[model samples]
Target: MIVLKNPHLSVHIDEMQGAELRGIYTPDARNALASYEWSSPTPVGRGASYGSSEMDWLSGYRGGWQETIPNAGQNCVVDGVELGFHGDASRTRWSIVDQGADWCTLETSTRLPIRVRRTMRLDPDRAVMYIEGHVVNESDLEIVFLWGHHPAFPSVDGGRIDLPDGCTIHPDVNRSGDLLTQDSPWPMAKTSSGEFADLSEQPALGSHRLLYVTGNKVGWSAVRQPDPYVSVAMSWDVAKHPYVWLWTMRQTPEYPWYGRASMFALEAQSAWPYDGLAGAKQRGQGIKIKPRGEESSWMTLAIIPNGSGTVTGVTKNGEVTFKSSEMH
Candidate 1:
């Protein structure tokens, strides 16, 4: 575990696990992101075989933050190479290229002819973490791939998800059978029967939903948890990440949850349709990297203690300002 700390916040990165962010802690030692201790053994890569990626991914998931690269969801074959569940980066060990008191850079070479690099820098005077990263295609052939961030936050009963003004929401699966089959504008979704359901408001326990939100005027999202009076916010480049994948689950009775977890993930993505790289190719979506080309972006995360109110925007420096001073 590589730890980076400033006066106000601390970050944990697991070097053996894709350099995955294990946690972000406030002054009170509370982690803004979700972390869990599952009953099963830790998950590890078992080579790229059919149905193995999903099993390994869920078995080893510990709920911090992961970078799903080359592929986002499910296991699929790309260019005759099997890309694991979230790609090889999430499970591959990363070599630390450089480090400082408040920042570190790690690099890894994946199964495909690509190299991934990520740098995490903690603000010295604020509760903000800055992440800058890029993927380089080493092969002579161009590569079309899906790149995204997966950060999970604990879900409170009355929590709310805040996005920019002009966004729309579409669910991957309507297991709840309430959300509309089509896209609806932010904070409001039409049910199959034509009634309105509040997409911003977190649902009750035993409920789970995976939604894809797009058409955002800007690239930012904040999840406010009222009970703890803390808000976890993320801001990124809209061009690099055009979509936000919202995954919410409360004590889901399934293989991974088993009625023991409640959390939501706000992911910044470069492509659409969670069917992995193959799906993205079928839909003509995702980033296309030229031979030996590189793609990079930056992300900012802030932990606000009294930021449960409506957040107007989050700056690149990690400052959170509400709509009014009263909300503070």
Candidate 2:
């Protein structure tokens, strides 16, 4: 386990277990964030790699946040080999290459010829986490990559989702209870049976819904709950990561889900359709890196305490703006 602190918060990363974020909680802030918890449950033991099977994949899950590369969905072929859920990034360990008083960096490489480096920064004055990352494609051939940041938030009965205008939804054809699969406007969609679903609100599905969203010129999402009023917001570079995925499940009866899981994962991704790189490439939305080339991006997340207001938007500098009104 690796820990980084900034007087107000303590961020823990499981360096040996897929380098996933174990948790982020306030230590001395004594504010609304003090009660914040990890979205993902702790792992049963050291996680096993996704061995082209759901059991192997989920056995390794210790999720708070994870990085997915080359692929971001279920088992599929990437560069001729079957890549399971979220690819090797979340299945491999990362090395702690650097650390200091308020920041730490992690680096990992994949057999797929990609190297990912992540650095997280915190400060004494704010309840936020900043992550900057760079990816290098060291292979000789240009390759399409489906990369994303998988930050799962615990489900709440009154969970409300917020996004910018012009956004539309694309339901994952592979998942069940796809209420809205077409290109509808943001936050509202009609099921195939013609029932309307408020995308902004998370409900009891009895099943699951996986989808990708477009029109993220304003790249951000917030999951707000009631009672304690603690809110979590995630913001990323829309230009680099143009797509966002909504992996909201309730009582999913599948093997990995086991009919006893509930979580809302608003994934900020760089590719599409969840059909692996081949599907993303066929649709021309898949991103590719030139031989020996690299790309960089950053994401910022905020923990809003007291949670009395709605986060209207977040600036590039990580300033969160909100109003007194709640969406739900």
Candidate 3:
């Protein structure tokens, strides 16, 4: 376990399991991250081999935050090249390149001629974490890949979700009941049962709702908790990562879920579903990387304190505003 610290927050990362963020804590809370209550023992050391995969990665799945490169969904084969879920980047061990009192940088390179470098920094007085990273294409050929961040946080029933202007729901990203292929504006959508289900709030028990957001001119998503009164607000570059996938899994009784765990994930990705590079190419959203090409973006997340309210907007300095309350 590698730990990065500051005055108000401490971020714990697990190097043994794909360098996932095991926990993100504040002074008031030990673990602000969402976790699964598995009856099974937590797996130690490295995970399964990429070749022996067909949706078995969740056998040892520990919910947290991880980076996905070139892929972000089920394992598949494209153009004779095999790709695994969320790709090998999250599964591979990352080495610490630099460290200091308030910040640390970790680096990893994948087999796809792409190298990723992520730097995490903390504010000394604020409850926030700043992330900066980039991908470099080492080969002469352009690489089409899905780059994103997956953070699973503790979501409560009735919590609210806020998105940017003109944001629309993506039907392909797994919806509950009969809302699978329906296209509707975010926050509120009519269910197949002729009832209006608020897509913005966390559903009741026994729900596995997945909502993806696209067509937004800006980049930001905030999950507001009504009980604890603290909300997590994330902001990034919409031009680079234009899509946001919001997933809530609760009481799923299938193989991996096993009717356990209650968590929500907010993903900021360059593209959609993890069908490998070919899938992005087919959607006409493939990024063309020239030889020695490099692309970069930054993200900021804050654990705002002391209020249960809706997030109206984020400032240029990364401070989230709760419309019902003041920033103090």
* Root-mean-square deviation per candidate: 2.3, 3.7, 2.6
Best by lDDT: 1
Better of 1 and 2 by TM-score: 1
TM-score: model 1 vs. ground truth: 0.93
Span of 10 residues, lowest total lDDT, candidate 3 = 41-50
Which candidate wins on TM-score? 1
Candidate 1 per-residue lDDT, tens place, 136-208, comes to 9999999888788999988887788889888878877634345656777888877767778787888778767
In candidate 3, list every pair of residues with a backbone clash. Answer: none
In order of appearance, the predictions have TM-scores of 0.93, 0.87, 0.90
Which stretches of model 1 miss by more than 4 angstroms? 41-51, 173-177, 192-195, 325-328
Q: Which lDDT values do the candidates have, in the order given?
A: 0.82, 0.74, 0.74
lDDT for each residue of candidate 3 in 1-328, tens digit (9 for 90 to 100)? 7888877888888765667888888776657678654655333234544334534456557688988776676665654677777777887788888888778888888757888888888878888888888789998877777778889877676677778767778655445544556678886766667877777877777777766787877788887776564567888877778888777887778656777677888888877654545677788764566778998888888886535466777653568866665444
Candidate 2 lDDT trough over 10 residues, lowest sum: 29-38
C-alpha RMSD (angstroms) for model 2: 3.7
What TM-score does prediction 3 earn?
0.90
lDDT value for model 2: 0.74
Residue-wise C-alpha lDDT for candidate 2, range 177-234, written one tens digit per residue: 7575576787777787788888888867574788789878888887777754457777
